[model samples]
Target: MNINLNINNKIYNLQVDVDEPLLKTLRTLGFKSVKSACETSNCGLCTVLIDDLPHLSCTILSVQCESKKIVTLEGLSEEVKIIGDFIAEEGADQCGFCSSGFIVNVISLKRLYPDIRDELFIKNYLSGNLCRCTGYEGQMRAVRKYLEV
Candidate 1:
């Protein structure tokens, strides 16, 4: 099947398997930042923004994303860079494997719920993304800083 995917502000019309995971298709197309630590969607490492919403690429078929706007970490806007910078400064990115997915979801959360500034809300929102490094303390601090700003 052929699908038209608008990813990172570029349109790609590529042929793909009907049952192929979007994560594979994206990585094949050079979107390496869309990592897949767990192909079963248990880990949020393969998360990507589909039409401005975060979705697990590993569980979603490439064909299912036809005509949708997909945004990976590479597609992050300047506004999100502030968050990234804060995270980096706070030493939140250890191992850095899950940073991209976490950042993508953070951007989604900010866009979806700008008024949710509580610490618990931030923690709850990021619960899906599992990070073995940094212990989430730095990440939480960065999130608090981002929300404060």
Candidate 2:
């Protein structure tokens, strides 16, 4: 099937498999920052923003995203410096495997809930994006600082 995808502020017209997951199609299109770890959607590593909301690319069909606006880590490169610096300063990043998805979710949090002032709310919001390192304390700290709460 042929589809048009609006990703990272750019439109792409291409032929895609009917059942192809957005993850595969996006990576194939050179959006390497949208990493894939668990294709079953358990990891949240393949998360991407669809129309300003985060969704697991591994479970979303490319065809279903035809009219949606998708955003990936590369799409939000402008934020990486600030958020990335915070994570690094707080020592929240380790192994770096979950950084992309976690950061994307953080971006969503900042955009979705701008009034957020509690760490618990931040933790609850980003619970889906898992990390095998840092035990989340540092991450929470970084997020708090990022949100200035």
Instruction: Encode model 2's per-residue lDDT on 26-95: one tens digit a residue.
Output: 9999998888898998888888999999999999999999889999999898787789999999989889
Q: Cα lDDT of model 2 overall?
A: 0.90
Which candidate comes out best when scored by TM-score? 2
Model 1 quality (TM-score): 0.94
TM-score of candidate 2 versus the correct structure, residues matched by position: 0.96
- For model 2, the stretches where C-alpha displacement exceeds 4 angstroms are none
TM-score for all predictions? 0.94, 0.96
What do the candidate models score in CA lDDT, each in turn?
0.88, 0.90
Q: How much does each candidate deviate from the true structure in C-alpha RMSD?
A: 1.2, 1.2
